[model samples]
Target: MSNESSPLQSSLLVSERMAFKLHRQGMIMETIGKNNAVCNEYPSPILPKERWRYQMVNMYPDSGQCHPFGRR
Candidate 1:
């Protein structure tokens, strides 16, 4: 046994640093819906692409622009 961290540990540290950097650069982990609210409390678990799709489909119907979920 040696008193040194493994390569995997170092890699994990670097990854965490990069994630923080990206987040600080105004890059949200997920997208907000039409209501201008995030679905989940934590944006990390939410997917941006899926949220965008849902917003578009819900905001605009096939015929024209309408509120599918009902006006708030």
Candidate 2:
């Protein structure tokens, strides 16, 4: 509300109504970022939660059987 404030200073000042809204929105976005950050650290797993188990073993078909050169 200061007449003395330059255009840039006035533009950046948060109004009373906008202050609360902006602060709340910023906090929500930060929380969402943190919650999903861990998943981004690793490559996606082949198995979904419903099929994967703590002690489960993954069995692969013979790779060399299909290769034209055969197993090396």
User: Each model's TM-score?
Assistant: 0.37, 0.27
lDDT of 1 by residue, 1-72 (tens): 143277534544454455555656645554445567645433453222322211234433555442222121
Model 1 regions lying over 4 Å from their true place: 1-4, 34-72
Worst 10 residues of 2 by lDDT: 47-56
Model 2 / residue 27 / CA error / Å: 7.0
Give the C-alpha lDDT of model 2: 0.33
lDDT of 2 at 63: 43
Best by TM-score: 1
lDDT of each: 0.41, 0.33
Residue-level lDDT of model 2, residues 1-72, one tens digit each, is: 476366433433333224345444553122223476553333222222232212212546544432111111
User: Candidate 1: worst 10 consecutive residues by lDDT?
Assistant: 46-55
Off by over 4 Å in 2: 15-20, 25-27, 31-72
